[model samples]
Target: MVFRSPYPDVELPDVPLHELLFSDLGERADRVALVDGRTGASLTYGRLAGAVDRLAAALAERGVGKGDVVGILSPNTPYYAVAFHGILRAGATATTVNALYTADEIADQLSDAGAKMLFTVSALLPTAAPGAAGAGVTDVVVLDRADGYPDLAGLLGSTGPVPEVAIDPAEDVAVLPYSSGTTGRAKGVMLTHRNLVANIVQCAPLLEIGPDTRILAVLPFFHIYGMQVLMNNGLRVGATVVTMPRFDLPEFLRVMQDHRTDRVYIAPPLAVALAKHPLVDQYDLSGVRTVFSGAAPLDVDLAAAVARRLGCRVSQGYGMTEMSPVSHAIPDGRDDIPVGTVGVIAPNVECRFVDPATGEDVGVGERGELWCRGPNVMKGYLNNPDATAATLDAEGWLRTGDVAVIDDRGLVTIVDRVKELIKYKGYQVPPAELEALLLTHPGIADAAVVGVRDEEGEEVPKAFVVGQPGGSLDAEAVMAFVAERVAPHKKVRVVEFIDAIPKSAAGKILRKDLRAREAR
Candidate 1:
C-alpha cells in the first residue's frame, strides 16, 4: 500500500526557479538576504536580485543560453548565490561541483556534465584551471579578481538588460548535482526547475523561515541538502542566511551567537557536538529556535539531550539526492513527532514499502525498501538511462535504497540503507570510487571500503586493504594516499590490513562481514 503525505498540498507555481524565488523581491528590497559569516558582509535582497540580472546578462553576452551547462565550484558564499541564480536566469543548467574535490575529481564531473562555462574562486585556480583544461572548458570565470580570468565584479558593471530566454520549467533541466544514487560511481542527478520549485513549496510548512528569521548556513551549497533546504529555501522565504565557507565548531557557534541566528540546519556530527562539545556551553545559543538535522540519521538520545540543553526543539529528516533531496521531514509546531523517527512524508509525496527480494509492495510496519514519488523527484540521472530506469519506475516512483518501517502514524524510522554509499558528516562517499582510487597505488593489491562509526558514533569511510607481497604498505600510508586523491571528508579515517576481503560467490564484496568485524 502506498502512503501519501498527510499535510495539505502546496500550490506550485508554473514558472522558472529564478522567477519563483525572486518574483516578489520588490517589497523585500532592503531586507538583508545573505551574510558572509567570515567577513561579516551582507547583501540585501535588492542587490542580490540586481546582481542576478547583471550576471545573467553578462553570461548571456558570452554566448551562454538555453542548453548550456555551467559549472560552479565554490563554497557557500553570497556570490555563490549570485552565480547560481544568474545561470538559471540565463536559461542555462547549473552543475554545482564540490569545492573540496581535487582537480581530476572536478574534471570528471565537468566532462560528464558537458559543462562549457565555469565559475570558481581565485583560490581554487590551481585545481580549477587544470580541471577546466581537462574538460575542454575555455570560458573560466572567477567570482573574485585574478590575473587572466574574467571576474564577476567586472561583469556586474555592465548594468545591461538580461536577454530574454524561453524556459519550459517542467522539461528544462535547471541544476545537475552529482550523487551516487543507491550505488556505484557518482552520476549527475537531473533536477528540473519545477522539481526545485515544488520542493521549496513542499518544504515550506516544515521550514518556517520568515523575513525576521536568521539562518546559519554551515552546510556547503554544492550538496543538495544545503542547496535546496538552506540556501534556496531561505531565499524563497526572505530569510537572512549567514554563509560559512567551512565548518569550524568555534566559528559556527560564534556566528550563531553573534548573528542571533534563529534556525540552524545541521548534520548528525554537528548535532552530536551540540549535545556533548564543551565549547558549545561557552557561546550563547539561546537565540536559536529550531535545530533540524539531515543528510544522515540522528540518535534519539542525542537529539533529546541537545534539545534539552539548548532549550529548542530538535528534528531529523530523511532525503536523498534524487528526491530534490527531501521527501520526509518533521513539520514545525508538531510537538508530538517522535524524536528518532523521520517524521511524516512531505506534502505531495507518495511512498511505498517494497520487498527488496521479491519486488512486491509490502504492508505497513513491514521492513522493505522505501519507494517515493513526488514532484521534487529528479527527472532522471544525466546520460545514464540504465541507472535512471533502474531507480525511477515507468510510473515515476523512485526506488530509494533505504530500508524503512512506517507506523500507523505515518512516521518513518530508517532501519538500514540497502545502498553502499557512506554518509560522512552529510557527504556521500562512494566505496566504488574509493576502491578504484586504492587500486592505483603500486603497493596496494586489493581494497574494500566500508563505513565504520567513530567514537562520536558518526559514520566514516574505513578501508580494508591488502598489500602487495613484501611491499610493506602501512595504514598511515594508505590513509595519506587517499587523503591526497579525494575530498577531505572522503579520506579513509581508519585502515585495517587484511590478507583477503570476504566476498560472495557472485564476486560481490560481503560488506556485512566487514561491518561485523568492525562491530566486534
Candidate 2:
C-alpha cells in the first residue's frame, strides 16, 4: 500500500488510522482546523488535536474501547467532527444518526447498531436522550451543554491524553452509515478504517485540494458525502473549512463572499440555487473556481447554466453509500464530457456494468447495473449477512443498484436507481418503512409509497392509500399524519386515496404503475 513518488521516488508513511491526522502534512499544527458557523467559533489544529486526545481519554475512562459503536446525532458544527474523530481515535466505531429523525427512528438505529454511548447537541437532547435510553444506551454526553448531559468542554479540559489502542485498519469498522439499499428497512453500512482512508487517498487527486483551498462546508457530516469530501479531505490537505449549521441560500452565498471560498462541494438542489435563484445576483461568486455536485443526479441544463452565471467550472459525480459515497468524480475544468455523464471511474477503482437479468458484463455504451470493486467499498452491512451477500459478490464487486451507461470515452451516466430507495434532497427515504408505518394507522387498510418528481424536478414521496372498509380517510389527513411522525424530508408530499393498491402476484407493490400515473 505504498504510493511511490514519480519524480523523487519518495516513500509515504504507512501509518494507522489514528496516525493519519497527526502525520500527513507538516507545519499544519498552526493552521485553522475548523470554523463553527453558529457562534463564529474556530479551533486551530493544535487546539483540535488536544480536544481529540482529551475526548479519547474521557471515552476510554468510560470503558469505551475498540469496535464499540458510539452514536453521534448532531448537525454540521465543529463539535460534530471533533466527536467523530475522537471516537475513531478511541478505537471505536462512530454511528452517525440523523438529528431530524423521530425518536422511534433513532431508537431503531441505536438498537440495531448496539450503540453504547451517544453524542448529540443540547437542542436535540430531548429527542435523542429518550431514544438512546429506549435503545439501552448507557451513557449520553451533550455538546456545549451546561447541564442534563456531560459537558464536552469540561471533559476535554479535565481528561489527560489517552494511550494508543491497537487497531486493525482492515477489519475494524470505523463508521456505520445507514442506507435502505433497494428494499426493506434501513441497515447500517459497515465501513472499515481502510475503506474510508483509501477513499480519502483516491479522491485527493480529483479534488486537487491544497493548503490554499477553502471549501464551503454546508453538507451534513452525518452523510458519507460530506464525511469523505469535506471533513476528511480538508484535514488531509490542510485546507480551511468554513462550516454552516444548515443550508440557507443567502447565507451560503454570503459565507462564500466573506471567506473567498475556492471550491464548493454541493448537492443537486444547491445547483438549482445557482441556476435559477434571483438572490444569486446579490453576491459575488468570482472566488469560487469549481463547484462539484453529487448525492443526486444534476440536471445537465441547470449545471451548464450555473457554470455560465458564475463563470466557474461545474461538474457532477455519482456514487452510493455502499461505495463509500464516491465512485466517479468529474474533473473541474472539463466540459468536453458528454452531457449527463458523471465522468470516469476514480483512480484505483474498477467499474463494470452488468445486465440485471443475466450476470454478464454489458458492452461499452450499453446500459445496465453499475458494479464497483475498490477499497472504497464498504466491508458489508452490519449484522445483516443476508444483505451483505446480496450486495457483495464472492469476487468482492459491490452491486450499486444504479442503472448507468458507460461510454467509449469512459464517462458514466447514471440513468435510474434499481433500488426502491427515494432521495429527498440527498437523504434516502425507504418506501417500505413508510408503508409499514402507514399500515399502523387505523383508517389505513394498505399503502404503497413511491417517489414522484415535483415541480422543482426533485423527488418527493407520494403515498397511495387504501382506506379500511367503511373507514373515512382523506389525503390531507393522511399526509399530515405522516408529516408529524417522520422527519420533514420523509414526509409524504402528495397523497391519494385509492380503492386498492396495485401489486404483483408475489405481493410486491407496483411502484412503476404509481410513477406512470404521476407522469400522466
The best candidate in terms of TM-score = 1
**Candidate 1: where are CA atoms >4 Å away?**
180-182, 420-520
lDDT of 1 by residue, 170-233 (tens): 9999999998322457899999999999999999887677889999998888888889999999
Query: What is candidate 2's CA lDDT for residue 163?
Result: 52
Residue 173 lDDT in candidate 1: 98
Q: Return the top candidate by lDDT.
A: 1
Among residues 3 or more apart in sequence or in different chains, the pairs in candidate 1 whose N, CA or C atoms overlap within 3 Å are none
What are the TM-scores, per candidate, against the unseen true structure? 0.82, 0.79
201-235, model 2: which lDDT tens digit per residue?
77766667878888888988888888778888888
The C-alpha local distance difference test score for the whole of candidate 2 amounts to 0.79
